[model samples]
Target: MLSVRSAAVRAQCPSCGTWSSRVQSSYRRTASDLPLSGRAASLAERVRRFHCDGAQRTRRIFAERHGEEILAPFARRTGRLEIVVHHLGLALGGGPGAGFARRLQVPVSNDTLIRVVRRRATAKAYAPPRAVGIDDFAFRRNCRYGTIVVDLENRGS
Candidate 1:
């Protein structure tokens, strides 16, 4: 476990780009970072809530921009960790990715890895084909069937 205590006072508003020293509230959050020495490390990061004083934009309150560069929004693990996880998920499929992550001491589930890959893939812009071919495929050999839509123009996917 990685123990962290609060440091630094920040007053910058992310949305409006204004600065202030007024403190609305202070709190601490638990975060999971990258593995250290083949062991999982966690953090007790201190966070601060600030009242937005900027008049340019209209957000009443804003949280401190602490670790925003290092961590993804609402994410426990650091951005670097997530990047490593995403690469693992892409190289190895879900189950294998999870197993590999365990070997790397990340300790994440297959579902989590799958979700990570999905999120990263969805971030890119894509143009869907205008036409598609629809067919029914045997999802299970004589038990069930599912509809499959194939991109007609591309002939792939």
Candidate 2:
């Protein structure tokens, strides 16, 4: 399963728009999902490093998918790490995102999680607009209000 996914993922390199056919190595990574009760849902994936023959050198390795899911590369804790960071942002008001990193067996920083979230938000905000709408929301929880612009063109919100 891993080999197949790796092969499929390595077939295309987004950086150079070239098809990769040579695989150098393979490995396994595990990731965690949202908690079920007090436990977390985990997934293990096989990853591969590919040799890119394209110009303008870029990343040589990427993850493949088993069935419908894309697996993470390098480590098994990617999912858990993301969850921790997201939860930290919501629970501790984003300031303790870094502190949560220290709690992980593997080291991470709050700044990294903040950066990831910011990047995702920026990407979504700047995505090409198809349809636009305007709405109003509370600015201060029943005290004030403001207008919000929404893009309804995209499928995912």
lDDT values for all models = 0.78, 0.57
In model 2, where do residues sit more than 4 Å from their true spots?
1-25, 40-42, 48-69, 73-92, 96-109, 122-125, 128-130, 135-145
Model 2: per-residue Cα lDDT over 56-154, one tens digit each: 667766433343224334434454456556566655654566665455432446666666577546755566787999999997889889998877776
Model 1 accuracy (lDDT, Cα):
0.78
- The 10-residue segment with the lowest total lDDT in model 2: 1-10
Poorest lDDT segment (10 consecutive residues) of candidate 1: 1-10
Model 1 Cα lDDT, one tens digit per residue, 2-82 = 655446565788888888677898777776778888898876666678888898768767877556546545787777788
Q: What is the lDDT of residue 25 in candidate 2?
A: 80
